[model samples]
Target: MKLTLIAAASTAFMFSLSAYSQDMPGMKMDGMEGMKMEQETKQAPVADAEGTIKAMDTSKHTVTISHGAVPAVQWPPMTMAFSVTEDQLAGLKVGDHVSFSFRVKDGKAAIVSIKK
Candidate 1:
């Protein structure tokens, strides 16, 4: 009777461990939880503006542009320096007329692309 009880308890313990392994919290068994969240919280659309480059700081990877209103981001026409990637500044220069795309997050603007 004791051995039979022990055997049943051990089997139940093993089955519980298996169930936990398959039902862990924060572990997406279906693998579509991330995709569902991604589809739900859609990203803000990219915004574009036309501007003249006022200054270019290659060392800082930044550019100051006098841009027209960016209606998408509700920004007025203004001169402000924005961080840019080296690739975006490849052939860009000060005083150049260019159309650019940017995203403003956390009150800081970052230029995504620029073209004359």
Candidate 2:
């Protein structure tokens, strides 16, 4: 009689455990359908470099700047001129303080965009 009770109790416990797991919000069940996972891919945030515009040449599509340190890339503040695409050079002027994003390409800093 004791062995029969023990077997019945164990079976009950197993059934309850399975039911609880199915009700859990985070649990995934095998052979279940219609569960759509919303996974998002996030891009890396753009790094900001701030400084005063030292010089700009719209014709040459280049700008010189003396900027504060950029913490994202561990860059120290220095005065340097960078090349920009002709389209990127629009509406920029020398001596106008600005913030910008750039990446070093072929040992030269290439300007991506300028911010007022």
Candidate 3:
């Protein structure tokens, strides 16, 4: 009778061990999934401006521009002279009607490209 009881207790312990082992992979202390990870990518902001060049200053590498309203990006087009790089000024001329792509950083607009 004692041998039978011992065998039954051993079987119960083994069964409980197997059940606990099966659950080990999915157990989470904070009630979160352990094996899944997620990552998000950030996209750069782009704005399009189409306008006529009012003036060009190759010495300062800046251009004065006047553009139509850019409603798609909520930027009201206006006349302004902006600082640009020497490489950007190379292809541009005064009074040229151009469409351009720009990005805003630190409250200033930087021209990315110009298309005639």
Candidate 4:
């Protein structure tokens, strides 16, 4: 469909401009089928990376990071938001570079551990 292609293209553009990892397609949860579903649901393996904090919202309990490509999830270098715990967001600020461990489930990334 036209919308799917457009969405895919838009995501690709955004990822191309992102700072973290590079080159792993398929971010939408609604359209996934087969291996795509497997990729989105696979969460046992943790991916590690170092990146700059782009934004954070304590109320939302999420942090946006600009990081390099994460092979574990096939994510391209780009900025993306991750759900975090209050402890994970503590003391971290925009522009702070930190290392973190995370896993992806249903196209959502959740931080397991983080430190500056």
Query: TM-score for every candidate vs. truth?
Result: 0.64, 0.54, 0.56, 0.61
Q: Worst lDDT window (10 residues) for model 4?
A: 29-38
Model 4 ranges off by over 4 Å? 1-43
- Superposing all C-alpha atoms, what RMSD in Å does each candidate have to the true structure? 9.3, 10.8, 13.9, 17.7
Which is better, 1 or 2, measured by lDDT? 1
Ranking by TM-score: 1, 4, 3, 2
Model 1, which residues run further than 4 Å from truth?
A: 1-36, 39-42
Write model 3 residue lDDT over 35-103, tens digit each, in one string. Answer: 454433333476788899999887976778898886655778689866678887777788899988777
Cα shift from native, residue 22, model 4 (Å): 47
Clash number by candidate, in order: 0, 0, 0, 14
Off by over 4 Å in 3: 1-44
lDDT by residue (tens digit), candidate 1, 12-103? 99999998779558765686645656656765577999999999998998999999999898889999999898889988788899999988
Clashes of 3: 0
lDDT per model, in order?
0.88, 0.79, 0.78, 0.87
Candidate 2 wrong stretches, greater than 4 Å: 1-46
Q: Per-residue lDDT for 58-116 in model 2, tens only?
A: 77778899999988877798898888887776776777789899877556778878877
lDDT of 4: 0.87
User: lDDT (0-100) at residue 71 of candidate 1?
Assistant: 88
